[model samples]
Every structure is written in C-alpha cells, then in structure tokens.
Target chain A: MSFLAVEELVARIPDGAFVALPPDYSGCAMAAVRGLLWRPARGLRLLGVPQLGLQADLLIGAGCVAEIETAALSLGEHGLAPAFGRAWEEGAIAVRESTCPAIHAGLQAAEKGVPFMPLRGVLGSDLLGLRPDWKVIDNPFAEKDPILLVPAIRPDVALFHAPLADRAGNVWIGVRRELLTMAHAARRCLVTVEAVTEEDLLADDRTAAGTIPALYVEAVAEAPGGGWPVGLQGAYPADDAWLARYAREARTEAGFTAMLAEFVAR
Target chain B: MTREEVLLLIAEVARLLEGCRHVAVGALSPIPAAGALLARELADGAMRVSILGSRRHSPFTDGGRELFDCAAQGRIDAFFLSGVQIDGAGNVNLLGLRREGRPIRRFAGNFGAPYLAFLVPRLILFRTDHDPRSLVERVDFVTAPGSGPPGVWRRGGPVALLTPCCRFAFRDGRFLLESLHPGHDLEEIRARTGFAFALAGEPAVTPPPPEDWRARILGPVREALAEVYPAFAAGLGG
Candidate 1:
C-alpha cells in the first residue's frame, strides 16, 4: 500500500480502472497516469468533484475520461467554454442540476453510506430530478418529509496531489482544501506529494492538518510538477500560452492527441 | 405548423430583444444574432451587434470591441444567457457531475453569469428545451444572483425566462408565463414542465421570420462557426 515513488505507484494501476479524481488539477497524477497508458483504457470514467483550474483540463486532455459530467458553471482559467456544448453534442459531456456545492454534498453523503442527507436549504430545485438514478424517497415514519437518497460512493481509486505529503502518505493541501472530501470518498488513494519529510504532518501546521490523514491513503508518490500542462499553486501559474494552444487543439480527438504529445514533450 | 412558422417564432423572440444596447450572440446563436441584425436594420443601425467569436471588432467602422467584453461596456442594457437548469427562484447551473455516487458532475461554474446578473439591468434566460426538468421549482446552485439582496434585482433583474414552448417573466415576486411560441398551446406547454406554470390567455403570437432572415443570419454564422469550431462544423452539413 505504501510506495515511495510515483512511477512505482502508477505501475500498480491496472488498465481500465475507473479513476475518481479531484477537480482543479492537483499535481502530476494526471500526467503520470497518461504516461503509463498507451491509449486511455475503456470504462475510463473520470469523476471530478469541483476544484477548478488545470486539474479538470488535464483529466479531459489525457483521453481517459470518455465523458465529462459536471455541475460547476465555468471552466475558470481552464477556458473550456467553447468545448462545453460540443462535448454534449459529441456525447462526451452532461451538465446536471445541482452544481458543485450540491455534487460535493452528495458525494459526502454517499461516502458515509447514509440513507439520505438533508442539505438545509437545497430542497426546492431541479437537481433533485436531474439524476434519474437517485431518488428523493419520502420517509414513511416522518410526516410531510422527504430525504434526498444519494447512493453510496466508493471510487475505485483516488489520485490526489497535495502541497505536502510524507513517504508514509500524510498529506496537506495548504490553504486550498478543496479535495479533502475526495480522499475520504475514494476507496483507494494514490497521493502525489510535493515534499516528503520526516516531521509529523499534524505538528508542522495546524491549518493544513485536517486536509488528509495518512491512514486513508494507500500510496504516496513523490511527483513534483505532477500537475503539468496544468500548473500547481505556489509553483507556477497555468501556462496561459500553452493553454491558448490547447484551447485551439482540444476541439477534436486528433487535436487532443497532438496536445497530449506536446504536454508530454514539455 | 410549418418550418416558416418556427422561423417566425424565432424572429419574434428577436423583436423582443429591445433593452440590450449591446448584445452578444454566441458563435452559432443565429436566431439571436438575426434578431440583433434585424433590430439594427429596423433601427437604422442604431443598435450594435457583437458576435462572440468573430475578429473582436468589425472592420466596418462602428462595432463593439469584443463580444466577450460586452458586459463591461456601459452601453450594454440587457444580457441574454441560456439556462440549462432553472429553479423557481430563477437560479441556474450549466456544469455537469464528474463522479459516480457523486449526485452531480464538477464544472467551472458560470463564467459570465455573475457579471451579467449584476451588471446588466435585464437578464434574459432562454432554453430550447421546455421540458419538465429545465423549468424547475429550484436550481441546485445559484452561480448568479437573479435578485441580489431582495430589492436590488427589482430594478431590472431576470426580465424573462424564454422556452421553446412558452415564455415566462418575473414581476413583483411572481413567475408569470408571458407568451407561447406559435402553435404551442397552453396544454402542451403545461405538459412539458414539472413545475406549476401559469398560462396567459391569447398570448402574443410569436412573430414570423422576414423572408430572407434565416439565410442572412444562419448562413454567415454557419460559415463563421465552421471556422470557429471546425469539428462541430464538420457535422452540420449532414
């Protein structure tokens, strides 16, 4: 379960594993995953919980996600606007009712295996029906009450990039704790750490301590610049020049492949 | 009744495009662009048209600098956006879910919804799908505040919610169905949505397209869209 290197960690994944990932390109997990696979294996559904930035773009660029379905509104700096409707037309995208907040809440609800979670004030919306699979079953015991029944979520594997993680898998997300739930929701986790230190992650900083516990993480890979093609915070701003080129190229499969090559070359 | 009627209804929607001093039509949003062009023609070039993907500005002298920058301009009076999911409160979300067991997908959230909702006096919501889901009791997320801080949006918040079947508007806290596109009856419109929608009797007949409107508007957009989006352009000819 414990791995010292990203290459060793990546070798553990079998082809065609359905990978659940964090949004807002984390580190080099996506680039490493793409480097390992010849072509993205079939049954590759990339489940991204809203994080924003290069994380989402790298997942889409890797050719691993057969379709992209999200509840967030804009791609932010990712600039996936033009590709938005086209992804739908190509049967590669779908926008559901509950945006990021609801999806995140739903995932948390599922990770707990709870029958239903009442999101204090989100009861009255179209998101309730967007997913035909989930039901808002009314409780028989409670009068005039209905609960949003979200199915349990157990990601086949979760790969996250944190600002810091020890070789033992203790992780810290720094100020941005966006993907904290993803680590808990994922069945198995592969963490790409920025730094591996012997100091206790909890003792180092109280602010980032609650982000991820080493107990839940199955492996730790020391993969810096893992969020390539997509930049990492405190490291570099997303290469706008490169992203502009990608915006032009990601329009088609052939173009996306070429983009992948350019990304790897960099 | 006929393709001509459908085209006319689309034009009528364009005619209603009055408040916007500066308007943005997407790369392939021909109907709205046609409406803008028609408005320009009718108003003797008074209205300015800014195409979202074109060369930023027109070489033909006067034009908005960039369609992307339309809202920033002081001239923009109204803004139009397509609502993929709308709640009774008028919130919308266009992002999809990214994980399974995850109730919904992850998306970038509204790029311009917040700005347009705040900047423009009137925010017009449109939907080609008049289905039950599109017009819902509530939206999952509020990317753009339709009525910010209660009375703030009363000045000119969500002016109207447009659908292929019917048109709805917000007036004094009530969501009213203003008109029905030609050939769509109250029953059909009511049947299409899951929410309780009010019907107006003898709603204004959606206008018909002027003779060469479709050719004038759709053709240029089709060509430009082909250039702007080649992969999508490849499939349109068939």
Candidate 2:
C-alpha cells in the first residue's frame, strides 16, 4: 500500500493532467487543494463534476489551473465566485462550458467504459452551438427525434476527501455515490480521509455497500479537517464565518492573494 | 428593488407554483427558495419543496446526481432557473459574454438547466435584474433553451418569466407580456426591455402580495432561507 504525504501525492500529478474534483456538497479535498496551492502546482486542467466552489476559485486565483471544464462555478449562497470570474474575464484560462446533466452523462460514460453517452437536452440551444465537439444525431430508435451526445470524461486522477477508510484502503462514502463514479471513471483515485481505521470496512455488509474497494484507490493520506471551510458530509460542518470572510475579502486580486498567503502559505 | 417589491416578486413566484406537487430550487436561488417554501407552507405541507444545499429541505442523500435523476424522472413538478441574460425567445444565457475564442465576461457555467428545463413541467424563469442588458434580444449563449424543435422530446419549458419590471408568459417559443409589476407600466417595460414581445391584450398590473403572505415571507420564510442563504436572508429587513 502506497501511503504518501499530501504534497507527494499532489506532486505525482504531472502538469497539464486532467484532474477531476467532486461537487461542492460532495466530499471535496480542500486539504489537498491547499497542499497543491502551497506546492504551487501549475498547468492543471481542472474538471468540475456539475459544480465547483472554493477549490476551483482558489486554484484559478493562484494561477495553478490552465483550463477548466465544468457545469458551473459559484460559491452557492456566498454569491459569485470572484476569482473564477476574474480569471475568466481576463481570458486567463480555457473554459469548456457545459450543463450539469451533460457532465454527469460524460462521467457516467467513462464509468461504464464507453466512448460517449447520449443526453436528452441542449437541443436548439446555443450551448450546442458553442460546443462543436458535442454532436447531435437523430434517434435511431425514434425517427425524427434529435438527441445530444457528449463524449466520456475520464480524468487522469480523481481526488476527493472522505470521512473514513479501513486498513484495506476501502473508503466508506455513504450515499455520495457520485464519488464512486468519479473513482471508477478516473485512471487513478487519490483520497484524503479524516481517519484510517484498522477495521475491515468490507467485512460488514452495510459498510461494504458504501465502500470503494482499494482496487480503485491509488493512494490514501490522512488529512484531518481536509475539507475545512467547505465541510465534509457527516464528518464536519462548513465553516460559515470563514466562508463569509472569504466571500467578502476575496473580491479583489490583492485581497485574494493576501488570503492565500495567510490561510494557505502559512 | 425594495424589500416589499422583493417580497411581492417572491409571492408572485409562489402564486405560479400554486398546484405544483414538487418544486426544486437550485443553488444560489434565495428568492425562488423563499417562494417555494412559502408555497409549501400555504399548501399545508401538501407541496414538497427541495432547496439544494439545505439538509432539511433536500430529501436526496446523493447530492446533485439524485436531484438530476429525480428531475429527469418527472418527479419534480416545477424548478427555477436564472441567467446572466434572457432573450425574447425564452432562451437563458448563464454563460457570460463570449468572444470568438473565449468569453469576455463569464458569470457562471450552466448548471443542470438544460435537462431540467425540458423535464420539469413548470420551469419558472426569474431574474432580479430587469433591464435591457439582461432582457436581451438574443442571448450570446443558450444554457437552457426556452423552446426546442418539434421533434425534440421535451415535456416542459419556461412557463413564466418574472422580472422586477413585468411577468412574461412563454408560449409557442415566444414571451408575451402578461402583467406589469406595480410601480411599473407597459411603456416603462417596453422602454427597458431589449427584446420584443407580444402584448396580452392590455397588460394588467401585478397584484400585490397578500398581508398574510407578506408576513409569512418576512417572518418564517426568512428564517428558512437563512439555512441555505445566510447572506441574503440576513440582509432581508423585517
């Protein structure tokens, strides 16, 4: 079992690699993101599975991300993601604008080992016009009906934070099945956990159902409070005050830089 | 807009959601979330309201995936979507201004709008900013098309577009002026609107929210919204 430091694990991700991050509400590896920022990893192509929040914004602000493919980038109720907006406006990063279901469809295709997946929406929309890569075809089964098809999204590495992992390296991610899809679709999976248990998670039928076997996971690192400020489901609550402060202070480049220096650099 | 105007807008949205069985409010939609909660309360729990990011409101354990699945399965009766720009054709542009190679102004990427717009029976389009820039003649990008081609399998599309200026009912791939909000007239709406729309006879003034509805929104609804939207809820005046 290769248990590496968060820095080492992040370092293994080569520049320009397609790295996928989970949704805001899902288990986000904010600790790993902080580690990457500290290392100042560059030229990454970040993938947002339907949505993105703090992780994407920070990476973009830090100039670590070269490109981003996502459904949306917003801080939810915290309002607009300033860093992401600034980067986008400056044309600093390449963006592949996509819809939520389409992203999910692409990931599902990758999980199923398919080249592409057909979706039911985006027809006659400018999203179709923008994404020349996405093709429209007549449904063979149903004549005269057009449908949209999106290519599979297989990331080079799927990174996320989880509540716990057993000695066997199986991570228990109850109800957050999209994380499972992410792991299955990616070439490799790197996970940060709040705790590493000596108990076998798969031995118990209940835990086994929610557990992602060690076979999919490439590396496991102990990262307590890894998803700080963002919150890890069932493990912690989102630091609302910190998030609010980030929203207020991170409105400008200098403010954002200062925040990174204090929160990440230190 | 004033707090009272905002409350009225919420109430109008709640009115549109009158008979909806299940209404889902997406991320960053405090006003719609308030409206849905209000509708649910008025229905005496007969209506199910699910706001994304709220543990109490959202029944799904699997996050957005479950929400999308439920929406696709026709389980969601109504849903709310907003955009940086909305056109006369009922198209919404969540993606900001696009140049040849990249966007000049990128607000946010399109969330699950495309699929949900087609699947949900009642898709209520709302935007607080009501001006020529927002109500454009044509969107630079269509994140969720208000209408699709005849052969496209669409069970739902935009039912009503409520702006601070007026309410537009979408029919046959076009928005028709239904009613102008109070303190605004048809002439003002026309002057402000960038896109052209058919008039529904004489545009009536939007009815003000009931006293009870206003009380509910200013009271319990504000509390409910605080769970998901602390900043917006906290900003709401009593």
Candidate 3:
C-alpha cells in the first residue's frame, strides 16, 4: 500500500500536482522535500502558519512553484515559533498568512472538494480582508456573535515527516504532534520517518503515536538527516556552523545554485 | 538608584549582543528590541535589524514578523524572550491558562521558538518578573531548548538568563549568579526565584551604563524604524 524507497515515493507525485507541507521545526521532512522538488515540474502550494520553520524558505528557494497563499498571526507562537523568522533574515522568499486556522481549514475544505465551509469565531479582525474570496455566512443557530465562515483548501498532496511511521503509512508524530491537523485534512498524504518498527500501531505509545489509522496514508519512506543542515530534536540540533555557512552563501543566485549542487551531487 | 538607573543598567548588557545580520522587534517587546538595536549599532552598519513580516528572505513568509523567525533557516545568533513558565531544562511557556469550561484562549505566538532553541547559537533569557512562577522547577512546554539540566548551558546550549533582580549564567549544567542588579542583594533576589543556584566567587557588580547607549543604540534605531513605522516610535516609548 506504500512505497519503500525515496525514488519510488517521489515517482508517485504527478508533475502538475499541488503539494502541501507542515512547517514544524521538530522533523527533517522539509529538507527531504527539498531534495524531491529540486528542478521540479510540479506546481507547489504551501500551507502553514508563517511562523513555522523553513516552509517559506524552501518554497521561495525553489523559486519554481506556481502560487502561494499566506495568513499572518502573532509574533511569538504562530509567527516565530518554528524557524521562518531565521529563514527570512538570510534572504529566503516568503509570504504572510493572515489567520492561523485559515490555511489549514482551507486545505481541509479543498480536500473535501467543497467550495467553502462556514466556520465560527472569526469576526472584526484583519483576517476578513486577507481572505476576500471566501464567503461569509451568519450562524443563525447561535444567540451570541453569530457570523461564521471558513475557506476550503484541498491540496493535491500533503507531505510531512514524523518521528516514526509504520510501513503501512501509520504516522507517529513525536513530541509536538503538529501534523495531526494536516494529516487529517489532506487529500493525499506522504510521510517519511526515522525508521519503521514492526510493533503494532496500537502498541506504539498513544501520546507519541499521533495521526494514526493505516488507511489514510499513501506512502512511507525512511530518510535520515532528511532534515539535514536543519536540526532534528531527539536526533540532532541544527548544525549551527553549517547553517551559518548556508546563511552566508544563500543570499545570491549563484550561491543558492552552488549549495543545491552540493546537495544534488551528494 | 532609579528606574533610569535600571534602564541604563539593562542597557549596559547590550555589550553582550552580537552576530546578527538581520533582526526584528515585536510589539510590546522592549528588552530584546533594545538589545538587538544596541547590537546593530555596535556593528556600525555591518548587521541588519528588522521587524517581522519585512520583505526579507525567510522560510516562513514575511507576513507578521514574529520572534520565532530568529531561528528560521538556523540563522539567528541570539534571541531574548520572557517565560510565563520555565522548567529546569529551560523550556518556556508564555501561554497563560484556561478558565473553567472555557477551553483555552490562546495568544499570538511566532511558531519558531523551538526551532530557535535547536538552531540559534545563543538564546538570552529575559524576564521582568523574578517570582516563583517565572522561575519554576520545570516548564509546561519545551517551547525552546535548555534540554538537559539547569547547568547544561555551559556545555554548548543556552547562554544567559537576565531578570529584574539578578543575572544568571549556565555553566556545567548549573546556574551561577553572574551579578546583581544595582541596589538589589542576593537574599532578596533568592527569595523570588524557584530554582537553586551557586554564587559566583565574588558577587560581581552589574555593568555600568555607557553614556552613549541611549543615543547610539536607541536613537539610530528609532530613526531607521520610523521610516516604515511612524506608530512604532510611540511603541518604543520615545
């Protein structure tokens, strides 16, 4: 039911497909994904809080993707929590998202093939201007502040990395469990893991075994240092010297190409 | 001697700020912005200091420039933040609490703090509050890394924790009292903290203020910031 190798896993993606990724800093999926999309023919659409790590950086670095939709949030938690702020400092291209749940909620709506979903609890905020295309409907059932509307985002593919994922595509997001929302919402999901163990999905620690159910997964593969240059906690932190070197080198086209060449050459 | 003395005392610590090419300041963030501006000034145009969502190259798009971007692409060299809850290992949690049956109201956070912890070379802890809740035995969440033990920072982890009462440094997995804020003694400082610490060989005096600190650091930054941000000048308490 799933691919065993990175090459095979990559092959499953069609050239024109739209891919979504989580922006969490806990895993190496972002780097592995970069390896997959170098010289990519597919149109990529990223969905995540602007605060998550390296999502905007990798997307802008690729510089080949079609369109980007973004929402903005607070500075501490949703905005600067992952590592996007650092990426921006080094000259990575990025767009801001207006609301925290809008991106994920939109993706979920798209996955369901719905035009839009009416969500509650967002009114009198700047999010209204950011998502002009979304329809706003009033919640007649409520006696309180009753306006509610949410956008749909059906990404063609969702790719992420987890601490441990089984061969059947059962994902085990470790500490943060940020992927639970993405995993539940995406149309097609691909996951990479540190390793696949033979233990039954139920036996895996529940608090640690996040976003399970073998049926929702399309593929699972193993890739170490997959996060590469970017650090993975419980595995390794970002190689600061290497990252600092990347910051210095990634500011120009020639520098970025040289860095890519090194990765590809390896 | 006065709040001005306190501000100058804190400003003197600006000497420690370094290694930034681009930096940002968030709304209601005084300490980090002040330190970053000071660091930039010391660099004499060699580095860049910015706010979140500026048109810079970032992994997360430039929307609302949040503090977490300090570790994006692992480029940030230092970060200064406060914690509502912190553990022995140095994890931070600023989220307040959930009321009875109200679920949990959340605050705006820049998502990359944890990434900063793992990636940034130095994380300078700053807190205006020096109470037991602020200096807990363990933090509720691992928002940033101070992973191993209290003294682990000396072995290649976080660098310092600055508070209103005193300054602390991580050495050999132990927190050592580096200095006391002017006019404050260790006994008074100790009464407010929740964790244990060692006294430095001699209680060092806090750094004296540089006469040029306000003009050199705060002045140029206000001018540069006023270009894109007229309202921000007011936020700076200028």
Fnat: each model in turn? 0.07, 0.73, 0.05
Best by lDDT: 2
Better of 1 and 2 by DockQ: 2
- Residues A33-107 of candidate 2 have per-residue lDDT tens digits of 988888788999988887788999999999999988888888876788989888877878888878888888899
Give the number of the best model, judged by DockQ: 2
TM-score of the second chain of model 1 compared to its true counterpart? 0.74
Report candidate 1's interface RMSD in Å: 12.9
Against the hidden true structure, what lDDT does model 3 obtain?
0.54
Predicted candidate 2 versus true structure: per-residue lDDT over B1-238, tens digit per residue: 7887888888899999999999999877788999998998899979999887787778986645788888878899999988889999999888778668555777767788777888898999999888999899988877888887677899899999999888999998899999888899888888999999998689988999889998888798889888788878877787
Ranking by lDDT: 2, 1, 3
DockQ class, candidate 1: incorrect
The TM-score of predicted model 2 comes to: 0.92
Kindly indicate the candidate among 2 and 3 with the higher DockQ: 2
Model 1 C-alpha lDDT per residue in residues B63-173, reported as the tens digit of each score: 111222344344566566665567666666654333333434334454345334555566677676677776766555555545644322223457777776667876654
Give me candidate 3's interface root-mean-square deviation: 16.6
The candidate that wins on TM-score is 2
Superposed Cα deviation of residue B5, candidate 3 (Å): 8.6
